[model samples]
Target chain A: MDLVLIQLLNGVQYGLLIFLAASGLTLVFGIMGVINLSHGSFYMLGAYGALTLTQFTGDIFLSLALGVPLAFVFGFIIEWLFIRHLYDRDHLQQVLLTFALILIFNEAQKILWGSYPHSVPVPGYLQGGIKISQFLSYPYYRVAVAAFCVALALAMMFVIQKTRIGRIIRAGESNREMVEALGIDSRLLFRFVFASGAALAATAGIVAAPLESVYPGIGEPVLIISFVVVVIGGIGSIKGAFVGAILIGVADALGKVYFPAFSSSVVYALMAAVLIARPGGLFGRAA
Target chain B: MHNKSRITRRDALKMAGVGAAAAAFPFARPAISQGAPLRVGLLLPYSGTFAALGDGITNAMDLYVKQQGGKLAGRTIEWVKVDDESAPPKATELTSKLVQGEKVDVLIGTVHSGVAMAMAKIAREAGIPTLIPNAGANVLTRAQCAKNIFRTSFGNSQPGVATGIAMIKAGIKTAVTYSWGYAAGEESVAGFKESFVAGGGKIIKELTLPFPNVEFQAGLAEIASLKPQAVYSFYAGGGALKYMQDYAAAGLKSSIQLWGPGFLTDGVEKAAGAAGEGVKTALHYVESLDNAENKKFRADYNAAFKRFPDVYAVQGWDTTQLLDVGLKAVGGDIKKQDDLYKAMRAAKFNSPRGPFRLSAAQNPIHNFYLRELKGGENVYLGVAAADVSDPTTGCNLA
Candidate 1:
């Protein structure tokens, strides 16, 4: 039973990490209404940027401070030059354009950093073990990461629930035509939201870089999992992204902890079960 | 008396001429060097998920081809390569193209063990020779063992056995392994488990990480709960990098030592970094090996590539070297499969990975030494040898 408790905690921790990754991906799709397949590419860039910045500054917090803004700036440039034009295009076209961006990002990353995984070390302050109990102990970094995720989740709720920007985002999600009919430009709002979403992805990437590897094709797996999150969460729902991310995370983590031989397959099983029980996700708006 | 002396000298010269003629005649050019640039089909992973890893191996082989003057023994070594994508069906298709379309003389390469097994069948069916660089799972030599197939790689079990024996000798008591679900990983784990158990060590936990989706957090957590003395794994390439970093973050670095099948060479150092510090694994070649032949190969290879040769590059270099030695043994008389096979089995070639002979199963019997990454290069500690037999590998390799 203690082992089960430990695994549940492990699952929650894993879920938190997945939520950090999937939240930004959900916003890019939900607010923008254009499928950004390369959202994970932004995450990868953020990780790479964090790696470089941390190495240069020798401070992980300062590195993140530097990377988050750079990610927004990169998103701005990419949006203005490449992604903005594809807004009115079909879903297939959007997928193709974003897929093309994936190749560009992968190659550009290789050309800039060479074909190797850059090791991102965890900050020295967060580098020791913490005692969970007399018999069990866990890494403080992981627990701190979980706390960080909760803080981010609270911050996200504040930004989207109580702010003027949140009102505009809600207007945009409900009815795009109606949002434009209010005499306020949705395009400018979308561009900013999209850019902010990119920053969120970068934030996750920076936080996870020291934990996971930063390498070529690194963005692709995350991108696919993000898609799974969006579908399961019901597109255009931030609350659903959180719930879906946690569900997937817990299912995946527990599956591996208890039944490692069937780890990958477990996520799909949960998705299947969710589809049967709740077709529109836990907090999704009804059509 | 002078005329008699001159006649004897002429007779001796005549004999010398006859001997020189016989010696040079086989290696001597016949208006054209190399026999029709014997087509060597490369069944490789050029266009797939494994493309990135395959790219390095393919680049090394092509580098060897160019360095050998675009020819092997005066014959152009034309590469008729197909991107297997590490898929079995695709590999079989490409082999058909190589056999029928390209009419290759010998087959080489194949990163995936399954792909290698398929190509082995092609070689057997077509009466051609196949030289594998690193697909060392035992199955290639066991159930599906063919006549003309030869491997230059240390068998799959060699690395695991080497690591297991070294850890056992090092006085480790408890160990846990994070192995992927594949023949390569499974075979290595099997070898490690056997040796580790026999050497009076206990396996506290054995975790298998599935392929395609490798989120290692849960596995790391489970293993941490077990509280083993040491941890070993067979995760390679990018996956290995993630495992190492996460392993470090999971707070196992200071408490539990990391064990691997020696994927800690220059190839993986980029992915692993400081977390892989003090990591011990087994391999036939370490960058720190000091020998006249290895020194020459290193200098020459570095001068050409501007970097130290990794295991993949070494494998490519050794493959060509073995081919050259076999050709020389048969005096480049590679008109028939039997001749090439016989010469290869002799194992008279000097390899970069020290001296070892080939088993009748066509796998190399070699020393698998424990090496560590120190100061950005592989440091060979001492002699670590494991005498592996030609046990029947149950690969269903095809």
Candidate 2:
């Protein structure tokens, strides 16, 4: 029971981190119709930025404070300069271009930080385990990260469901032409969503840096998982992304623990099962 | 002045001759029969994750060559470089390019087992004197050992076999094996199981995760539940950093004694920081190995690279020495393939790690040290196995 519970918590913690990265990707994909493969680059940039900032500042909060906004600004610049042009382009072109961006980002980082893997220090206050029961205790950092993710998820839901901007984003997702016809300029909306999504991925990167360590190509695995969550959650749907991310997180954690032989293939098997049944994703609309 | 004003046929012919010689210099042949520079092809990753390791090997190899006044085996050295990229699928293509296109006299590679295996196959077929500086898959020395191939590095099993012996000697009654599910991991674990069981230790469980994955909560939870006397793990580089941190984070540091192959704490020991303290590992080379050669190696490497040399660099340093023996014995005539092989097999020398020589399988037979991390570096504990030789069952060089 303790094993299951602790692993369940592990699954949820992993899920929340994935959601932070995938939510932005799903929003960009759903509304903009631009398949931005470079979303993972933003996550990588966030961790790198945070790591550098932390190295200089020696404070986690300060590093994240400077890093998250830096990622946002970087995202905004990228969207304005390059992503805007890619909106009307085909997926193949977008993939090729973004794949090139991945290479560029990796090389640029190597030049900046060298290829050596680096680590971020957890704050002394948040760096211990919390006893949950006689048999079980969990790391405070993980629990704290999970809590922060949950709160962030709620805040995102409230923003997308209640605000005027949320309405614009929703309308943009359902029908971009109609949203434009209704005098809602989606160009600005896309730029906002794209930048915000990049920021979220950065935020996740900052949070995850302590757990995963910062390295070149660190964003790649998370990026792949984010894609899985976004596809599973139904692209562009925050609710679906949340559900899908947690499911994958738990499934992956449990799979690794219980099924050593087939653990690597389990996530893909989940994707296949979802695809066969829905052909889109669990919460994804039919293409 | 009057003579300069006239265009002389002899002067023009002299100038043309010089120009032609200069132009033909790069493509010119005939130095092979003499003691000209031997072309050594280096097939190692220069890009991607393994790039750092590859650079280390290259640096050590260069350092060794420099120490010998830019010559090895009485022949001046010429290096041909190619990036293996640590991709196994591209191994054959890369090796073929080096052996066939570059026409290198000697082939040296590589950091990945899968790629090394492919390079080994090509080197075997071509009868080229091949040196593997660092990958440690057992099959290269066992089933796939070649007459022309030599591994200056330890096999995957050597350290694990040492670890198993260490564990039993330490009186760990029951243990669990946890590792990444890959060839290196599986082979290391297999070696551990062999010695551990032979030493009358009972293994409670064996756990594994896919390669390069860091999420170890579930696996940790299982370890906590089982509460084995000890746990043996095998992971390297960035993955090692996370595992050490997670293992400590889970509060297993105080409870379950964690033992692993030396790579678990090698290059990434600093990154692991406090979490790595007191963790024991078995390996062929440790940074703090006390010897005159190791002292010089560390000091020279620190001066050259501005950092303490790691295991890979040490392995690379030994590779040049291993090759020098062969080349020196054959009088720089690498084309004397049989002679080169025989000389390399019989070559004995004091390495940075200690006394080193090849087993019948052409793999290193040397002391494996039991080391512990203290103050963020590996401190040599003791020798777990001395003059430990490979089983070399399937290899039939005779």
Candidate 3:
């Protein structure tokens, strides 16, 4: 029973972290109608940024504070220079352009950081485990990360469902022409959405950096998993992503413990089952 | 003027005849001259995850050549390099290009075991003399052993067996085994189980997850509940760092002893920080091995590379040393296959890792040291198994 409870927590923590990465991809695909294959690269940039900034600031939180805005600006520039041109193109063209960006970002990371794996230090305060029982103690840093992700999810929900910008964002997602026809600058709104999405993924990377090793190609795995989450949750539904992420995470955790041999295929199996049942996704609109 | 400048059929026929003769003349001479350069193809990863390892091996090999005044066994060396990208699917094509296309007389490679397996199969079929610097797949020197192929690195199971023996000697009778679900992991655990069981130890459980996956929460929780006396695991590079961190973070580090092959702490110790300390492991080489050859190699490597040499560099250096011994015995006549293989198989030299020689299966027979991680370094504790030799299972050498 204790094992099951702990595994559930593990699944939830993992799911929330991945939700941060997948939400950005779904938003870009949903709102801008652009398949940004390089969404994972933004996550990589955040981790590397945290690695560099923490070395200078001597604190992980301070590094997070500085890295998010820098990532926002970087994403804004990337959209203006490359992604904006991709909006009007076909999915194949968008995929090609974004895939090329993935390759470019991977090589650039190698040139800048070399191939050695690095780790960001958890701050002194968040360095130990919180005892749950006689045999179970969860790391304080992991608990803190889970709480932060929950807070971010709530804040995001409030903005997208309750604010003026949120309304315009949803309006653009449903019909870009109608949003533009209402005298709103859809292009500028899109730029903001893409940048904010980039920042969200980066924020995940920064917080998760201390939890795992930061290395070249670290983002590729996260990217692949996030795509699965997006597809399972319906491409543009943040609520769906949340539900999908937690489901996959919990399923993956339990599967690994009980079915060690086929653990790697568990998430894919869940996705296949979901797709077979729903055709679209649990929250995805019919095509 | 245009008609005069254009090539006539007669002129083209004459040029074709000349080209045919030029190509055929080389085949007429059966043997290469003694002083001619020997073509050595280096099929190793120059990009991807193992690039740093590839560079280390290449640099050390080049350093040895430079030390020998840019020649070996009275012949200048010609190097041909192809980046394998550490992708196994591309290995056969790359090996063929090096052997059939470039006609390299010798082959050296590879950091990834999967790529090395493919390269070895091709090199064995082609009957090319191949040296493996880093990959430690046991099959290379066990079930699939070939006369033309030699491995300078230890087998994947050697360190695990050493660790098992060390743990039994330390009086730990109950333990669990954990590793990535791959051939290397399985083989290492098999080795550990063999030794541990022989020494009257009982295994509590065997846990595994997918290769290269760092999510260890579920696995760690299980370990905490089961409460084994010790845990033996196999991981390297980034995965190793994360495993150590997770183990320490779960509060199991104080109650359960963690053991693994030395790769558990080898290259990622600094990044692992406090989580890596006090972990015991067994390996064929440590930076602090106290020996005359090791001391000299360390000084020379530091002087040349401007950084401290790791186990990969030591393996690379030994590879060249073995090659030098073979070439000197054959007087640089690479075509003397019988004599060259005999000399290479009989090679005995003092390596930086200690006295090195080949087992009957042509894998390295050397000491496995028991070491503990202290302050981001593998502090040598003692010899876990001296001059350990692999069992050479299923190797007929036919």
Candidate 4:
């Protein structure tokens, strides 16, 4: 019973982290009608950025505080320079450009940091474990990260559901032309959304940095899994992404424990099961 | 003035003609006969995750050459490099480019086992002198063993075999074996099981995840529930660092002992920091080996490279040392293939990893040291297994 509980917590923690990444991807793909393959690079950038910032500032939280804004600016520049031109192009072109961006970012990371793996220290206060049983105790840092993710998720929900910007975003998602006809520039809106998505992904990276240890190609796995999460959650539905991310996290964690041999494929198996039942994803609009 | 100018022009033309003839004379003779630079093809990952390992190997090999007055066995070394990208699919093409295209006399490689396997197949078929510096695929020196191929590094199972012996001696009677489900990992576990089971120890369980995956939460939770006496694992680079951190974080570090081959804490010691404390590992080389050769090598390498050398660098240094022995025996005539192979097979020299030589399978037979992580360094505890030779399983070196 204790084992199951701990595994569930592990799955939930992992799922929350994945949701942070997947939520950004779902937003960009659902609202902008853009296939952004380089979304994971933002996560990589955040982690690397955290590594550098923490080195200089000597604080992980401060690094996150600074990193999110910088990532937003970086994303704003990227959308303006490249993604803006890609808006009218086909998915193939978007994939090509973003794929190229992945390669470019990977190379840039290599040039700047080399190929050595690096670690950021967890702050001293959140260092030890919170005892649950005689043998099993959860790390305080992990619990803190989960709490932060919950808070962030709630804030995101509040902004998307209750605010004027959220109304504009929902309206833009449904009908961009109508939103533009209402005298609001949809282009500026999209750029903000894209930048916000980048910031969210970066936030995940900064928090995950101490745990995962920053390394080359770190973004690639997260990117692939986030895409899965987005697809499973219904490309444009934040609620769907949340449920899907949790499903994958729990399924993946439990699978590793129970079906050790087939653990790697368990997530894909879950996706297949989901797709078989709902072709449009759990919350996707009927096409 | 006209006469003097004409004479000077004629003299300059004469000198140019002589210089051109002197350069052309070497090309006129048959290549590889004598007095030509020995072309060594470096088929290693110059990019990607293994780039640092490649750089370390290349630097140490060059340092060795430099230490030998920039020549080995009376032949100047000429390096032909091709970045394998740590991709096995491209290994054949890259190896062909080095072997047939550049016509390199010696081939040295490689960090990834898959890439090394492909390189080994090509080298065996082509009958080229190949020295593997880092990759530890057991098949290289086992079923696929060849006279032309030699490994300065351990087989995939060698260090684990040593670790198993150390664990049994340390009174760990029940343990769990954990690793990524790959050839290297499976072989490592098998090696550990061999000695551990032989020493009257029982393996409680074996757990594995897919290769290169850093998710260890579920695995750690299971480990805590099982509550084994110790946990043996095989992981390297970033994955190793994360595993150590996770193992410590999961609160299992205080209860269950963690052990593995030296790679667990080898390169990522500083990054692993406090999480890596008291973890025991068995490896052929530790940074603090407490030998004169290792002491001098460390000092010299730090002087040259501005960093302490790791196991990969030691393997790189030993690759050159083995090459030197073979070349010296054949008097630098690489065309003397049979004699060169014989000399290399008989090679015995003091290496940074301690006394190194080839087993009949042509893999390194050396001491595996049991080291503990203390203060961000692999402190040498003692020799876990001395002059250990890998069992030449399925080898038929005809």
Candidate 5:
């Protein structure tokens, strides 16, 4: 029973981290109507950025403070330079362009960092675990990450659902022309949304550095998993990403525990089942 | 008397000419003169995941050639590098290009076992003398053994068997094995099981996760529930780092002893840091091994590369030594395939690790050291198995 409970917590924790990454991807797709294949590269860049900043700053928080904004600016610049030209283009063009960005980002990272794996040190306060039962204890840092991500998700949900910008984003998602007709420059909003999405991925990267090894191609796995989450959650829905992430995470965790041999395929199997049952996603709107 | 001496000299010259003709005609080479530079094809990864290892190994190889005054066996070596990229699907195609296209005199590679297998098959059929410095797929020396193929590294089972023997002797009766589901991982566990079961130890369970997956918490939870006395795992690179960190984080570090192939702790020690403490592993080489050769190697390597040499570097360095032995034996005449193979087969010399020799199967017979991670470094504990050679079970080299 305790094992079940601890693994559940683990599942939720992992789900929340994936959601942090996928939320940006979903938002960019939904709000900007741009398929950003290099979304995961933002996550990779975030970790690499944190690794570099942490060395100079000697504090995780300071590194994050600088790293996230740097990612935001980098994303903003990428939008103005390359992605802006693709907004009116077809999905095939968007995919090819974004895919090119992934290669560029991967190669650039290799040039900057070399191909060795690097680790981010967990700070002093988050070192120990919180004991849940006599035999089970989960890492305090992981729980902290889960809690923090949940809060961030809630904050994002509040902004998307309540604020004027939220209404514009919603309107833009439903009909970009109508939103632009209302005197709001959809282009500027898109730039903001794209950059903000990149920041979210960067934040996920920073928090996850200590848990996972930071290296070349680290983004690829997360990118693939996040795509699964996005598809299952319904591409543009923040709630869908959250629910989908948690479901996938918990299912993956339980799957490994019960079915060790087939654990690797469990998440994909979940996606297949969800696709068959829902046709869209759990929270995704019918196209 | 002068005329008789001239006649004898002429006779001796005639005999020498006849002998030279006999030797050179069959060998397909005139002499080991300063001919065209020897084309040494390097089928190693230059990019992707194994790039750093490839770079280290490449540097070590260059160091050896440099040490030999820019030549091996009096022939200047010219390197034709093709990035193996550590991709198995491309291994055969890439290897064929190196052999068929470049027409390299010798072939040296590679880090991944899958890639090595492909390269081995092609090299064997083509009769290209190839030295594998790192890949340890056991089958290369055993079932897939070839007369021209040689391995400087240990078979995947050597360290596994060594660790198993050590563990059973140390009274680790019940253990659980965890590994990525792949050939290398399976081979590692099988090797351990062979010696462990024979030595009267019980493996309570064997758990395998998918290849390239880092999520190990569920497995750890199962391990905690089972409460095995010890755990043996086979994972390398980033996954190894994460596994070690998770093993410690899961709080099983103090309870169940952690053991693995040395790769689990060797390269990732610095990144793993405190979490990797107290983990025991077995391998053919350790960084802190105490020996004159190791000392000199470490010193020279540090001077050349500006960093400490790891196991891959040692394997790369030894590959050149292996090449040198063969080349010198045949006086740089690589075309004399039989003589070259004989020279390589007969070489027994001290290496940076220790004294090692090629077995009848052309695999290294070297000592395996049991090592413990103390203070973030692999401190050599003891020699687990001395002069261990792969049994080469299914090989029929004869």
Candidate 6:
């Protein structure tokens, strides 16, 4: 029973992490009608950024602080320099271009950091396990990750429903053509949205590095799962990404504990089930 | 600028061979056993995920050539190095290239068991003597064992069997085998089970985690549910660090002893810091082995690489020495496949891990020792084998 409880927490923790990564991808793909395969590469950059900063400063919080803004800036620069031009292009082109970006990101990282997986430490205070019960304990870092993602989700809900920028984002998503006719710089807005999406991905990478360990192709698997989350949630819907992440996470957690052999298939099975039921995903809309 | 040593046709040919080997396939030739420079191909992944160890293996082979009066027998041993990319398809294509195009007399070096198995088939079909340094899939020397293939390094069974014996000797009853659910993992666990049952030890659970794709914490929780006295896992690469960290974090470190194959001290494990410390492992070789060969090897490696050689590097070096003992004895006449095979089978070399015997199954019956990490160094605790050998190889030599 204690073991189950611990695995349940593990499910929630991993689910929250998935949400943080998938939300941005879903938004960009759903809103702009662009499939950004490079989204995971941005996350990888963010992790390397944080790792580099921590090496220099010896402070996790400070590195994350630097990492977050830098991720945003880097994403903005990439969107402006490469992705902004790709907005109106076909999704196939977007995929090809972004796939190229994955290679670029991997090579760039190798040039900057070499090919070794850099280990990131959880802050000393948060490194130990916290006993939740007599036989059950959880790592503080995992709990922190859950709490952090939960707080991020709340902040996202607020930004989408209660803010003018959120209104602009929503308006732009609903009708890109109409929003452009209203004198809003859709070009600049696209750059902003792309950058923001990139920032979110990087944030996930930075926070998860302590558990995942930052490596060259670390973003590839997460990118695949985020796509699964996006498809299951209704592309472009924050709420959709959230639901998809939790569903996938729960399935994955249970699969590992029970059907150890077919555990990997469980995540895909959940995706297939969601596709069959919802057709367009929970929060997704038809073209 | 046109000095013969500096710029020559030989250099261009060498460079072309390397460049072609790197890219541009379709260079595979037939089994041409015409008296060439006794070309010995050391096919390793030099520019892939396994490059860390591959580079070391290449260097070790080079060192062996240097020791052999810079030549093999009367001929200057022409080494044809090719990258396998750790992919079986690439390995298959490349193995054909090495055998057919490069006309390599002997084939050596592989880090991935999958690639090794693929290469083993190709080499055996071409009637080439293939000696593996450190790819530990038992099937390579078992069900699919090729007649032409020989292994010098320890197989997957060593770790599992040694750890199993160690567990029984230490009075552990109910143990759990946690391993990556693949050939390598299965071999280790099977070996462990065989040895464990022989010693009257009982295993309650066998948990197989996916390789390079496991959530260590979730695995840990599942393990805790088993409530076994000890947990033995055979995991490698980045997974080792995460397993050790999560095992400790999940509080399993206090209750169940964590043990596995010797990948706990890989180069990637070094970055794991204190997380990997105290994780018990079964190793074929350790830096702590008290021997003159190892002492010289350690000093030379440290001086060259400016770091202590890990399992990958050490295995590569030892493989070169292992090959040298056999290749030189037959005067590198690998064109006589039977002659070379006979010579190597009768071959025994001094190594840091002590002497090993090549079983009839083309696999080595080797020593296994229980080891642990002490400040980033593998410290051997006890010898699991006193002239240890394997009796379970299923290789069909007929």
- Winning candidate number (lDDT): 4
For candidate 4, the chain B TM-score comes to: 0.90
lDDT of 1 by residue, B169-277 (tens): 8889999888887777888888889889999999987888875345776777677678888887887666777777677666677777888777633476745767777
**Model 5 residue B310 distance off true place after TM-score fit, in angstroms:** 1.0
Residue A112 deviation, candidate 5, in Å?
Answer: 2.5
* lDDT scores in order: 0.73, 0.85, 0.86, 0.89, 0.86, 0.76
In model 2, the clashing pairs are: A233-A240, A234-A284
The CA lDDT at A130 in model 2 is 75
Residue A118's lDDT in candidate 2:
68
Model 4: how far residue A48 lies from native, Å? 1.6
Clashing pairs in 4: none
TM-score, candidate number 3: 0.91
Residue runs of model 5 more than 4 Å from their true location after superposition:
A133-136, B1-34, B46-49, B101-103
Q: Compared with the true structure, what per-residue lDDT tens digits does model 1 show for residues A211-265?
A: 7766656666677778777778877777777888888888877787667777888
User: Candidate 3: lDDT of B292?
Assistant: 100
lDDT of 5 by residue, A1-287 (tens): 47887778788888999999999999998778888999999999998887788778876777888888888898899999999999878999999999999988986776677666677887788887875544345787887888889899999999999999998889989998998888999889898999999999999999888888776677877889999999899989999999999999999999887887788899999999999999779998875
lDDT of 3 at A82: 92
The residue-by-residue lDDT of candidate 4 on A1-287, one tens digit each, is 48888899999999999999999999999999999999999999999999999999898999999999999999999999999998888999999999999989986776677666788999999998888766667899999999998889889889989999999999999999999999999999999999999999999999999989887778988999998998788988888889999999999999998899999999999999888889779999864
Q: Rank by DockQ, highest first.
A: 6, 4, 3, 2, 5, 1
| Per-residue lDDT of candidate 4, residues B114-208 (tens digit) | 89999999999999999999898999999999999999998989998999999999999999988989778898899999999999999999999
RMSD of each: 10.9, 7.9, 8.5, 7.9, 10.5, 5.0
Chain B TM-score, candidates in order? 0.85, 0.91, 0.88, 0.90, 0.90, 0.85
Q: State the displacement of the C-alpha of residue B165, model 6, in Å, after optimal TM-score superposition.
A: 0.9
Candidate 6 matches the true fold with a TM-score of: 0.88
lDDT of 5: 0.86
Write one digit per residue (lDDT tens) for candidate 6, span A1-287: 57677777788789999898898898788777889999988888877787778788786778878888888888889887888788768878898989999987875665566544557877888877887544335888888889999999999989988998888889999998899999998888887788889989999988888887666567877899999999888988999899889988888888888898998889899889988888899877753
DockQ pick, better of 2 and 3 = 3
